[model samples]
Target: MDEKGGAIMLEELAFEIAKAAHAGQTDKAGLDYILHPLQVAAEMTTDEEKAVALLHDIIEDTDMTANELLAQGLPDNVVEAVEALTKKHNQNYAAYLAGVKKNRLATAVKLADLKHNSDLSRLEKITQKDRERAEKYRKAIEYLSK
Candidate 1:
């Protein structure tokens, strides 16, 4: 297979892993969890960025680890971007978002994630936790845009 073919295959594998990891899960709005990543990936401008977006929540929400992502043959840059997007358990949201902003590709993927996550209409169905998250995303956007 050619280089492009390999990238396409890697991307397919990322989608499969993400889909399975998020299976049976639903967003706060009661939508499939996979929909969130897919939406974020759709807004990306590059294949690598899309792959990072797809796997953004994998390490955070699933049993998958960063080493597993590297073993999957994803490029180092993609793995790094995904890692930046994954929030650590005890990390402050602002600090995490600031780190993401340091990487251009990660920033783009994160902005897409924030855009979907902070959608105004979804506020109607959001819980207190979701409201707080939305506010965090809003503040992060402001910080990143500066």
Candidate 2:
């Protein structure tokens, strides 16, 4: 395939991997798990950012690993941005948000993620854990805005 084709293929592959990884999963609102990544990707301004957004939860929520992402031919920067967006186990929300803020692309993706996760309409279905997460995201938004 040509260069352009390869790029397009990679993009498609990223979406496919994300969909497969999150299959059978659902959000707090009972929406398909894939919708979150799709929405995050839609909010991004660049292809690379969208790619990172699409795979943001793969490492944390699925069996997919960072090494697998690289082996699948994703660019180093995209992988790095995805990594930055992923929260490490036991890491504080503020610390994870700090990493996201440091990376421009990751910040963009994370802001979108927070926006979707914190939507007012979703409040009715949210649990205590969701409330805490939303609060953290709100704080992160403020921190990132500065």
Pick the TM-score winner.
2
Residue range 6-97, candidate 1, lDDT tens digits = 44566677798899888998887788899989989999878888888999999989898889888877889988988988889899877898
What lDDT score is found at residue 48 in candidate 2? Answer: 86
lDDT of 1: 0.84
Which ranges of candidate 2 are over 4 A from the true structure? 1-9, 123-129
lDDT of each: 0.84, 0.84
